[model samples]
Target: MSFFSKLFGGDKEAEKTALDLFKGLFGENAKKDDKPEDKPEETAQEDNTSAPADTGADTVSSGPSGDSWGDDMPAEDNQYRHEGAFWLYFEGIFDIEFAEYRYEKQVLTPFKRIVYTFYSGETKVLAVELMSERCSAYKFRNDCKKAGLAYTRFYIDHSGWWNTRSYVVRRMKEALN
Candidate 1:
């Protein structure tokens, strides 16, 4: 309700004394029934039923990305680790080995290096490694240029656990073609 309506409306209850407003703002209402959270905060008991089930391992769902990563890379590995959003979105286009991939902090401080090796009927055609994170676009461009690839794009892997940003492993073919 608008301020004017509340102040001058037909409802008598809406006409509040200055003291009522003060008490509400300060949370100093005399009666305990004023607030729904009258009692102390309820904490879960140590019993298994009360407590949440804890799985030791942290896992993300195989990524279900809206991003059609690419159609260039053919489906060689029939048995992909997991079928994720990539499969459902572009099911007939291509087969991608989509899975719940957890980023491992490597020898290089924070960035997790992901490598993709392409094959044509058991013969290896290309193998690319996405390295060098957190640098400038110039740096990435330079890296891509140096590697002879046309472009580089950031593919977000949202499995489930954590929303890891700045991890770029998108199939360069997707955006270009």
Candidate 2:
């Protein structure tokens, strides 16, 4: 094990030398095997059972689904086109905070944008704040309806005024959709 132990004809070193000698005599690429530190690298075929992946640009398509992008937005939609930006934002919150919302479940979260919420077991809830007076509460409510989450509003006064608004959403129907 130790250098001193090996120098004194240790059993471990004797075993290693015998193995090396045998490998040198009959192993494939024996000349390469002379360097004891080197190991035979696995070919790609040996490493993966699946066929080689196609990486051509023409072959690959982008979106929420690798088959196509987000199904919510179509490929030809003018307002919501497939931009790489959405994927980056999607990947950022996915698994870390919003693992519940995935393709199979058909759940969406407001993580990258306004509110942050997801299905907690059976109940759907969201943590949302009204940032501006101009922002429509109805639009926010409809968004929550679309996602099947309860719409709970938390307001904070950032206009240097003293009116601060905050509350936890406890009601199933009133607070959420």
Q: Best by lDDT, which number?
A: 2
Residue 168, candidate 1: C-alpha displacement in angstroms: 10
State TM-scores per candidate: 0.23, 0.25
Off by over 4 Å in 1: 1-133, 155-172
Q: Candidate 2 on 1-177: residue-level lDDT in tens?
A: 655356546766445544543553456744532432232221111111233332222211233221111112212221112122322323343344445543222213221124545556655565443222224446766877797655554222112111111112122224544
Q: After superposition, how far is residue 93 of candidate 2 from its true place, in Å?
A: 20
Name the TM-score of candidate 1.
0.23
The number of clashing residue pairs in model 2 is 4
lDDT of 1: 0.29
Candidate 1 lDDT by residue in tens digits, 73-158: 11221111122321222222223332222212112212223334444456433333333222232554466567654543232221
Task: Please list the residue runs of candidate 2 whose C-alpha ends up more than 4 Å from where it truly belongs after superposition.
Answer: 1-113, 121-123, 158-166, 169-177
* lDDT (C-alpha, whole model) for all candidates: 0.29, 0.33
